[model samples]
Target: MPLENVHGDPIFTKINKVKKQYEYLTEDIETDVAIVGGGVTGAILGYYFSKANIHAVILEKERIAHGSTSITTSLLQYELDSNARELEEYTTLDNVITSYKLGLKALDEIEQFIKEYGNKCKYEKKDTLLYTSKEYEVKEMKEEYEIRKNAGIDVKYISEENNPFSLDLKAGVYGVNAGAQLDPYEYTHQLLDVSCNMGLKVYENTEVMEIAYGKDEVEIITSFGYKVKAKKVIIATGYNTQRFTKRNFGMKTVTYNIATKPVKSFDGWFNKILIRDNCDPYNYFRTTDDNRIIAGGEDVDFYTNIENEKLAKEKYSILLNRIKNMFPNIKDIEVDYEYCGGFISSQDNLGYIGEDPNHKNLWFCLGYGANGILFAILGGMMLSKLYKNEIDENLKLFKVDRFDK
Candidate 1:
């Protein structure tokens, strides 16, 4: 498959300066593990594998961190795509609680990495608000708050009488220290840089054309016909995994985003909290380190040509007007960037990680859905441990064959 236009003019790519350039595969190579993508998820895998003394190499069809990673909102939160009560229909309530805890653990892992290395990705811990503007949905919001609070999560409930945000909210769940945001592109490079120092090789403009699985090792042939022999193969190629398998992993959609230029003031946007509303095709808002407000989430069904200029204009326009209406007090809301990218969501709102049950040495670390970045963090930790023959119980929750009959 050819490289499709996975993203538009994303804000992260324009704001951050190029830090490093990697060469394409010039000669055949062999390693313990071969990562098939060079985005944030692949970089995270490289970091963990190198730290565990595993020989790993990353292969990218294009430049690193230029695909779906570039367009990510990077709103790190412990919440799933649905409320606990709703998700229970697909997964156990206990599992939902566990996933939330795992998300927090992933957030802490990112913080620890920033502390040890420098904070090159504009990392900041912030609060999150899941609000509902409709009066009828107030009961659902209260149930969500109670579920989180009962799970020992630090959360507060706010109704119309005590709402603190500028938006009219019938009910909301205020998650304290439960979310964070960062520059996904910068963080990808930072992880790759650290991994390179620990003996991880990365190749750009090197697309994997074919893979021949062997009894003990798999041979991956690049577009330039260079071979990579690895004992294990991890597909971290985001939602572009049709060549690797025929199984339908999840529902793919195009999510749009618009970023405003640095505003003079935030007005009534309390703490600039990472805000999401309880709507079917929801919208989320977050403030950048430079004072720009990013609003995303007008999703449409995925199509072969994601670069539909006409639909893009419509979605971007919707997002622009949304931010303006949400924060009327903030003036001069000029859209600095407009972009949309492909996103995937699972039935249970979780990611697929660990080895494929059918393919012997083949693995997948697909962190689909709203919690993608956080799920990728969890993937890095769990997959690395699996390489050391240590089993993380959480792996069952993300089994690649969970949907298989």
Candidate 2:
């Protein structure tokens, strides 16, 4: 079932139109690989697998890219939701650094894709500012900065005196050319647009009803009473993986955002850097190509049905007030769009991407963090390598059984 729509219109769908659609699956088919979701992760997998000369098809329960992909803030950062220093508590510092580098590589891969194909999405490279208004967080931020700097990452520590923003920041970490922003909806379709010509088959309005695993092949029965046989299956269904596994892998949360009308200027702000704070339930805001400010934060515990219009209004009001407090210069600021949606963060703050331990040839490409898009790219690459019998040592860090006893 599709997740309920909670609030105002998503800003991305407003700016972009769906370019492609597929008829529902009504007949049995066989393929080398079958992808179970049509969100960004599935689209990415479809692109990589198709490019590798592997036959692949995407089965989507609803319209492609209409799920969580549409509501993404699309802030492509190399940093994780849990900073490097914090992640070290869960894994080795070496592993943490490797994950960070992997994020940089994924970001570069996206740039390359845009270069080879065309940038249908509004993609742009930008600096990132991870700042803190609270004095207490300055120490941790500095530690994070030193760790990244020692690991050869381009970063700097800035105090309030040297801060470029009008906001009162006690300290901040300035990541040079470390982030990018784009229209995710357009990116998803653009990927499909390229992959479709490469023999990638995509079908929407197709739901997988049951799965029967075999030693050599996996068979999926769809709601339309059609069978799909594949040597391997990848579930990119985002937070709806309960139908396959029930290990409590995903930590779902409700996040909110408000997009303001295009502003005339960013007068006193820093170089349009992707800005996020160190505060718990931190606030993040960035500017779009058309000059609109999209800011989001104030996450709450997940609720199944978030379609409460009144609650959405209240949430938007709070978000707008926060924006006003941060940028007093954006006078008469009003929200042109507002929305709330569910997203998953993993226990270790890293994404899970590997074959299922109990089921051979059954794989997962769940990118379960704020770096969902980047992790999706990583998953696609790694999974493709795994299928071709190539070793990817990075998979050790994101093993699906990492939390298993």
Among the numbered candidates, top lDDT falls to 1
Least accurate 10 contiguous residues by lDDT in model 2: 1-10
Check candidate 1 and list the clashing pairs.
Answer: none
Clash counts for the predictions, in order: 0, 0
Best candidate, TM-score: 1
Residues 1-405, model 2: lDDT tens digits: 435533557798777766777889979999999999998889999999988889999999888998888788999888888777677677788887888899999999999999999888999998999988898888988998999999999999999888777888899899998999999888999899899999999999999988999989999999989999999999998888888887577668788888999888886677888988887788788989999999887776776547666766777898888778878776857789887787788766788899788997888888887889999999989888888999698888788889888
- Give model 1's TM-score versus the native structure: 0.98
lDDT of 1 by residue, 233-337 (tens): 999999889989998998888889999899998988988899999988998999999899999998888785476889888988888888888788988899999
| TM-score of every model versus the real structure | 0.98, 0.97
Error of 2 at 6 (Å): 5.4
